[model samples]
Target chain A: MQIYRFEDKKPFMEKLEELLKSGFTSRQLEIYLPHPDHEIEELVEEYWPKSKLKFITLAGGLSGCSAGFAFTIFTSLDWPLITSGKPLVSIPPYIVIAFELTILFGALFSLGGFLLLSRLPSFKQIFHPEEYGNEFVIKILREET
Target chain B: MSHKDTGVVNQEVNAKSAAQVKDQMERDILAAIKKPKPVYWLGLLITITMTLIGAAAWAYQIKTGMGVAGIRNPVGWGVYITDFVFWVGIAHSGTLISAILFLFRARFRNRFNRSAEAMTVFAVMTAGLFPLIHLGRVWFFYWLFPYPTQRLLWVNFRSPLVWDVFAVSTYFTVSAIFWYIGLVPDIAILRRVRTGWQKLAYAFGSLGWKGTFKQWQHYNQIYKYLAALATPLVLSVHSVVSWDFAMGIIPGWHTTIFAPYFVAGAIFSGMAMVFTLVIPMRKFFRLEKYITVDDFEKAAKLLLFTGMIVGYAYIVEFCLAMYSGNPFERDQFIYRAVGDYAFTYWLMIACNVVTPLTLFVRKLRRNIKYLFIISFFVNIGMWLERFNIVVISLAHDFDPYAWGTYTPSIIEVAITVGSFGWFLTWFLLFSKTLPVLPITELKEEAE
Candidate 1:
């Protein structure tokens, strides 16, 4: 393989022109250099450009309310539950319990998904090591100056 | 004076280190599962056998009639009623941890939320069975509902049992839907990650999720809306549950305070149950890192706080009975301390009150074994609380002629055992079949 060297932008352009004239195409490809304008495009388009996001935070607000009401009703006394002159199945009071169970169940399900995805409690190997670090194959490509 | 290497942002190859960490975590999980001795299985088997015997007793009850149980005359409700109360309380902790904390934006919930939710669903299923089993002729149980039949009679929406029917039914439906919906993406991840039977099972559960952009968007929107709607329900369900007894005119039962008090106790007891299940779960599932000690600590502290609130309610009720100046009300309070059911009331006080206070010690709260011990005691206390509330009030009332002592027959105990077995069996199945965590969400959050 022949290496190309450039001392300045003029020489670099000349080398590129020579390569074009020589009808060069890259077959021994490893890594391609990035263009300057790509950064701007990425800034506008990427959903997560910096830190990798991990989980969806879920709060089961309404479901908790519904379940709480159900909990209240089931826990009450037998036969005619008319207390202190209130209606047997007081609608006004039951709302408190219905709400709690609803939210509770909702939050729980959310966690199940969150944990599985993160590979949590996965006390075994999931992925090979080389995939994460820049250890395998081409590390970097450089031009001589 | 200072030369810093700021240009080198990337670290040298850390492939080996990363691989080791990944492999270690995997190995640890496998080891965690393996560590639970065969004895645990033997215990489960014994429990199942006991449960089956209980089921046989239930078969006899079905054939002989509800009359076979001790309930009769003034004591139409006995052990079945107590069980209904107990199971409902057991079901409470999951929602209390998952929903209430979630609404408060507590991150501590993330650790054990999955297991807690599973417990809630199972507990509710067990709890729901009690009311139906209490009905002598389970076949005609549908008659309790208010529906238009050719005979032209409407159900008494006035019945607390009716409210209970609606409340528990709604809870089961909502909980079932919510639990399944939350598992969808996790199931898909499992489908992709697992092989053979696991892949097929996860695939079936995931219903062909492709991780499409559209799917994520829709899933997030629906989940958000459901959470908003479900938040209020957490309080509402338990409040309604309180009404089923608060509506009763019995001296102890008819108190207005029962609504909020019961709701608080439900949450308190429910939180304890979560600790009870979670301590073992993290160990069994190798979820120590995900469900950290911090979570266990927070939960234990919460159990203490609730236990105190419940204790306060107990004292307040006694004082209020005195203040009301009603001789009958005064006597009911006195009887609670020294009557046929006196042993139950005192035992309840010890279990629900004295025992849980032991958790006030920070060291005790942090210890998993101690937390497990205390959580179970909380459950016992809660169950007794329900027993005292229902049986004590019913067994003694305004008219001495109506006074009666009630004891649970063997049939009643059997059915309760069976219901618990059923719950445990379902959980066992779920553990084998599903990935208990949401992988996609974790990826997003962690990244």
Candidate 2:
């Protein structure tokens, strides 16, 4: 494994781009950043695919919307009692619940999705993980052929 | 010095400075968590003591009965309700700073977002308590949720109070998750720097973040998405809270404008609170280099902007009341200005309206000391604004016979004070335990 480290993002990105241009696939190169950088993220995205976390957020949001409405409607209809001379199934107020649930579930699922995608909470890594302080690192996993 | 050689030299110089700055950022932030001065302990002691007093008062109320609280008929909601709204309002600008400004790509947010998010989480936790405290039977709080009860009854879906349950709970959950997400990388840093038990604790807290490209890709996506989600969520929470009153048929409470008005006021009050907490924090932690006066000026501009919106709301409320020729609405507004709580009304106007106007002047807006002093007024004023809305409306309402005043009993006062203690205790602990500034976000500025 070839490990290249830089203290500056400019040099780091230049080195990363240089590797990408020299027939090094993203699969063979692992990048580590002390902080999330837009330029590096974009450069990585060029070789690697876009993150799939958005799908999880969308799915979670849709599910939450349906659940919110279904829960409110089903519960209201179960009793069949109405107050304030209003309709039995109130869509207006339920929309508020649905909207809130959309954000709530979307946020939570995004976090879960992030953890899952990132392979977080790894017991091994937690106890004994690789530590890099304030460096942009790119480790070449293997040379092609 | 040839041009090509000078360019190379500049690049080298820039790289060296960036490296130095990155190191400096980490060291400065980590140093804050290392030691506590006597004043830190003193502040902690006072807040803990206050929290205990508040808890003791709550215990007394639970034991003695709801009668111990001053809330009675005609004024079924008093300080407790005001506190609920106030604290919830206080939470808004945290999200505004952390989530909304983040979306706007306002870099200044980096200075305040971490502590602001912390404040958001803690404030919501504090606000969540008032509802349970307001409940005469606190144990039956579960009834607020739509659960499978033995009686087969569900909470009223049409009620604003029920909506409040969902809004506030979701606000709490989402803000908490967002806060934790922002902390993960910072926690990883702490885990690396600390020793023994501290490292172990931070290890668990960090969830074994490796700062890999893939991890950061997902992390950035979720952070952006959460900011988008929380922007609307924060606005909706206060609107839903406002509806708790607006949906009512009570003259003063029933108004369509309450939604936007309350939201603007929430942001306004929340901005003041950010100042309230952050100014002293910036001073104590000696974070002047990170949270600069320029950042304060930008935040002050936001404060001024929101304050004007709130002031417009105050005027528009009165104008609408008078224009409608509704005696109850007119009486409510008139009574608010000159009746039992007139002092609070004017105080709110002076604090929320007049105080913020001072910021329009460039010097005052840039003056951190002046901003800090007025934040107290805004905090008090915002609390009173909620008081005027909740109690004043219920006090006079439609009937002359029911016209009565409400004064918060000692128990209620103690609990109200205690809520501040509860919020501060968490914040004080947080300051010592966690990075008060987002170390990762600040590093982005180095490049």
Candidate 3:
């Protein structure tokens, strides 16, 4: 992993565009930044077009909605008690549970996706520059010829 | 080029230097976390003591039963429910500032969102305790959850209390996640700068973020989604809380207007709490440059807006009560204004409605002292507002035979003070331990 440091964003972005234009594969190069940069983000999107993050959140929401409804309905049926003489499968109050669960599961799953996709909890000793949080550093993983 | 044009271009160029802004932000924000002042420790000690008192009060209440806490036949909800709602209200400002304001691209929110979110997490923690305290058997609180039990009795899905169990818990989970997710980058920054134990702790918490573009991109996406998810919660949590009353048959509790009314009041109180916490926090941490007076002015304006909404809710509630020709609702509203609890009702009006009007004056809006004082009044007013709605309504409801006035016992008072102590303890500790300002967000805003 070869790391390059730039004092300003323009050169860093220029170098990023050069690498992308030079046909660097997504796996062969990675850009590290102190914060999100719009230009670099655009370049990354152009190079690596797909991100599975949103799907994770969507899947979690659907699962949560189903689980919320199932839990409420099953529990109500299990008890088999009449509440305010309302229907056994109450939708109005159940919607509250469904809404809460949707958010709860969506957030949890999004965090999970973040951890999984970002390859976090990396206890391995990887090359990380101290100024990575203070300055932009791009690392290029080149294959041996 | 003109001199002014050259000067403007130079300023823009200087601001575009990411290295300088990043370095300065790291130094400024990290300094608050690294340096431990004596006053912070003193504040922590005071809060710990108050928390212990609160714990002791709870222990006494537990041993003696719920009767010791001044909740009786008519006023069964009493101070515990009031504090619960008040703290929950206080929790809303964090989500409002962090999620809602972010969606709106409110730049000033960057300065204070971290602290406000932390406040939300802790305020919810404080609020969670009230239901347990209200429950006579705190140990059996799990019965609220719909677990497969031997008795086959599930929590009633039709009940607002059960909705509260889900709503408050979901709010807490989402708020904590949103707050922690926002802190990841900052935590990674801390891991870089700190030493030994602190570095190890931060490293573990930060999940080994390398500031890679991929990481930030994903982080940014998740943050947006989480913010969007939390926005509705800021409305729904309070609305569901309002339904805890609004769904009831009690005269004051049974009203359609309670949903939006409670939501507005929650934000109003929450904003006041932000001012209450941030004023001294910015001073104590010496973070004047980061949390500028401009931020305070913006927050004050938000306070004014929410306060007026709350004021409007109050007026509308009264008019609706009068116009409905429902003697029960009308009597409850009149009783609130003229009955035994009228002092509290009037005080609520003065604090929530009258005091915030001063913010309309530009000079007063910018005055930190005035803001602080008004915020304090607003906090008291919000608490009183909850009290007026909860206890007063119950105390004066139908069946004059069952109507009764109630007062909080010393134990309940102690617990209330302790809740504040517990909340402040977390805030003070957080100020010392983490970046009070979001360093990355601040850098982005600067750009």
Candidate 4:
């Protein structure tokens, strides 16, 4: 195993790009950053596809919208009592419910998707993991076979 | 030294400086979470005592009955409702800073977003308590939920109260998740730095965030989506709160403009509260380096902008009420200005409208001391604003015979004081426990 660390992002990006150009597959290499950097994200994505968290958010939002409307309409119909002489099913007010649920579920599902994709709450990593302090690190795990 | 040797030395010096900056950023930001001083304990002690007073007052109300509150036949909704609106309004600025400013790519947001979001969660928690307290029984609070019953009765979906239940609960959940997501990486940093139980706690809180490329890729995407999601959610939550009044046939309460008007006022008051909390917090935490005066100036601009909108809303409300050709509405507007609650009405105008105008002056905009003083005024003014809208309208409705005045009983006053205590207690604990500033975001900006 080989490790390279840089204190500055500029030199760090340069080194990563140079290594990539020297024919190291993105999969064979591991990277650590103190903070998220878009430039590094784009560079890594050139080898891998982008994150699929959006689909999860979309699914959560759509279902929430439907469930909101469905629950409100169903319950309204379930009792069939109309006060204020309004319609038994009021779309205007139900729209508010649907809208709120859309955001609530979208946010929640996005968190779950992120955790699943990132493999968070990993017991092994939580108790015992490699630690790096304020460095941009690159680890190459195998020789170029 | 030759030119080539000088160039090599310059590069070394630059690299060393960059490393020092990184170290300083971590040390400065994390320093807030260190062992507290006597002053910190004193503040906590005071807040906790206030919280108990509030709790004890609440217990008194529960035991004595709703009669202990000044809320009676005519002015049924009083200080409790005002507090609900005020606190919920307070939560708005957090969303405005963390989610809305984030979308706009306002760099100033980094300095205040963590605390603002914390305020959002805490304020909403405080706000959520009022409806139950107002419910009198408080035990039947679950009746607000839309569950089936033996008689097959269901909660009125059309009622704005039900909408409020959905809106506020959703706001609380989403705000919390957004806050925790932001904290994960920072907690990971703490996990590395601290030892013993603190390290274990942070490790659990961080969920083992290693700052890997894959983790960040997903983190960035979710954060963006959450921000996008939160912007509308924040607006809608306040709008729903407004609808609780707007849907009513009460003269002052019913207005088409209430949605935008309340939304703007929410942001305005919320911003002032941010200034109120953050100004002292910055001094106490010694975060002047990270949270600079320039950042406060930028946020002041937001407060100024929103304050103008709120002021405009006040004028528009009056003009529309007078021109509305409805005597009830017209009387409601007149009573707001010159009636029993007239003092509160003018105070709201002075604080919400006039005080913020100072920020238009460049000198005053940057003056943190002046901003802090004005923040207190705005907080009081906004609370009075809600009080005027809720109590004034209810105090004097259509029939002159039914009109009645309200003076909050001592119980109501104690509960109000207690609410502040409760909110401050949570905030003080948060400051000592969690990373008050978003260290990861600050590092990103520094880089």
Q: Which stretches of model 3 miss by more than 4 angstroms?
A: A125-133, A143-145, B1-17
lDDT of 4 by residue, B1-447 (tens): 122212322343455765566677788888988999999999999999998998999999999899999999799999999999999999999999999999999988998999999999999999999999898789999999988788789899899999999999999999999999999999998999999988899899999899888788899999999999999999999999999999999999999999999999999999998999999999988887677777888899999999999999999999999999999999999999999888889988898999889888988988899999999989998999999999999998899999999999999999999999999999998998888888888777666
Chain A accuracy of model 4 expressed as TM-score: 0.90
Per-residue error for A104 in candidate 3, Å, reads 0.8
lDDT of 2 at B64: 96
> How do the candidates rank by lDDT, highest first?
2, 4, 3, 1
Best-performing candidate as measured by DockQ: 2
- Residue pairs with backbone atoms closer than 3 Å in model 2 (clashes): none
Candidate 3 C-alpha lDDT tens digits along B1-447? 122212322354476575765687678778877667787778889999999999999999889888788988888899999999999999999999999999999978988899999999999999999999999888999999988888878899899999999999999999999999999888888888877787888887887777877788888889989999999988999999999999999999999999999999999999999999999988876787677677788899999999999999999999999998899999999999999988999999999899899899988988888999999999999999999999999998889999999999999999999999999999988988889999887776555
Q: Residue B174, candidate 3: how far off, in angstroms?
A: 0.7
Model 2, A1-145: lDDT tens per residue? Answer: 8999887778888888888888787578888999888888888778778999999999999999999999999998999997989999979989999999998899889989999999998888799979878888999999882
- Candidate 4: where is the Cα deviation over 4 Å? A22-26, B1-17
lDDT (10s digit) by residue, model 1, range A33-57: 1111123223222422221112332
True contacts kept of each: 0.03, 0.84, 0.70, 0.81
What are the per-model C-alpha RMSD values against the true structure?
Answer: 11.4, 3.7, 2.9, 4.2
- Tens digits of per-residue lDDT, candidate 2, B1-447, equal 122212322344465666666777788888888789999999999999999999999999999999999989889989999999999999999999999999999988998999889999999999999999999999989888888988999899899999999999999999999999999999999999888999999999999999999999999999999999999999999999999999999989999999999999999999999999999999988888778778888899999999999999999999999998898999899999999999989998999899899998988988899999989999999999999999999999998998889999999999998999999999999999999999888777556
CAPRI verdict (incorrect, acceptable, medium, high) for model 3: medium
What lDDT score is found at residue B54 in candidate 3? Answer: 98
Instruction: Tell me which of candidates 2 and 3 scores higher on lDDT.
Output: 2
lDDT of each: 0.62, 0.91, 0.87, 0.90
* Count of backbone collisions within predicted model 4: 0
- Taking all chains together, the TM-score of candidate 4 against the true structure is 0.96
Q: Model 1 reproduces what portion of true contacts?
A: 0.03
